[model samples]
Target: MARVVVDVMLKPEILDPQGQAVQRALPRLGFEGIADVRQGKRFELDLEGPADEAALARIREIAGTFLANTVIEDFVVRVEEPAEAASADNNAEEGAVR
Candidate 1:
């Protein structure tokens, strides 16, 4: 199984009304060291199968075609490996040292 972590953010030039409102409120609330706070979105997807070429391709297509707006927003996908893959990496390190 794979856990796909996606981050979607607005382009820098795009104005974020909600984030600006929050930024304005922070100073009144005495929260210091707060600069411009532009909010974005995070999505965690539980993928049923393995993370292979086809799966990665599908993820990119989905993000570009629907999830992320090509004009104003951009997205990045991070694929988390399965438990077995993690163990295999650990085992490889153990053997490499011996």
Candidate 2:
């Protein structure tokens, strides 16, 4: 099955309190050298078929209408390679080295 990934993130002008909180906590938790953090949401949709142009268009509409607040957030929708294909590519790279 194909997969559609929707990434929703606040606009650069908007303040992200949740992200700030995490950033602050990270320092307290002994993590350092991080100057900034912006949190976002990711939605994974497993499709029964390929994510063609029409399907991508529909997903964009859905993302703009319901998933992201266009006024304050921006969203991106993309197709993801199947897990098997990705692993196969990785395996090929590994084999090529040896």
Candidate 3:
């Protein structure tokens, strides 16, 4: 088993009005030193795999095919080994059970 973490964001050249709105709001909330802020989405998944290399390869495919847009957005993917993945899955499942 493997775990995949994915992050997706708009292209650099693309403008995020929502993010800009949040940035503008920050100053009023007494938060400073943040020159700018861009917002995006996060996804977490657990996938079965044959090996670390293969898992990462599959993760890349998943990101390109469904998790991210090759056009206006970019994605980052991370794959972890079975031990790590299983532990996290167990924790998540346990939480669900509760």
Candidate 4:
């Protein structure tokens, strides 16, 4: 399986109340070095197969249309690479299943 990661974040012009609240509380928590904070969402999707060019295009369309609000948010989509040992193990398991 392949993993698709989507990161959605509010546009700079938009007011992020949740993020602002966290930022305001940071100083009280003794995290004074931080200048600012912007909260975002991450979605990980496990696809049944490899993400080819067509699949990537479809994922991009999905991100733009469903994962993010174009008016006040932006989304980024990318294929996630498995860690080295995990990738090898997954490949080995697939070979055994075949």
Please provide, for model 1 over 28-84, each residue's C-alpha lDDT reduced to its tens digit, 9 standing for 90 to 100: 999988889988888877789887788888988988888889799989988856553
Q: Write the per-residue lDDT of candidate 2 for residues 1-98, one digit (tens) a residue.
A: 78899999999999999999999999899999999999999998887878999999999999999999999999999998765435656455544422
Name the top TM-score candidate: 2
Candidate 4: residue 45 Cα off by (Å) = 0.8
Candidate 4 local lDDT, 12-93, one digit each (tens): 9999998999999999988888777899999888888798888889888998999888899998888876764245554455
lDDT of each: 0.81, 0.89, 0.77, 0.84
Candidate 3 lDDT: 0.77
Q: Give residue 47's lDDT in candidate 2 (0 to 100).
A: 77
Clash count list over all predictions: 0, 0, 0, 0
Listed in order, each prediction's TM-score against the native is 0.76, 0.83, 0.72, 0.81
- Per-residue lDDT tens digits of candidate 3, residues 11-93? 88989887899999999999998887888888978666443777778778988998888898899886555565445554555
- Where is model 2 more than 4 Å wrong at Cα? 83-98
Off by over 4 Å in 1: 81-98
Best by lDDT: 2
Model 1 quality (TM-score): 0.76
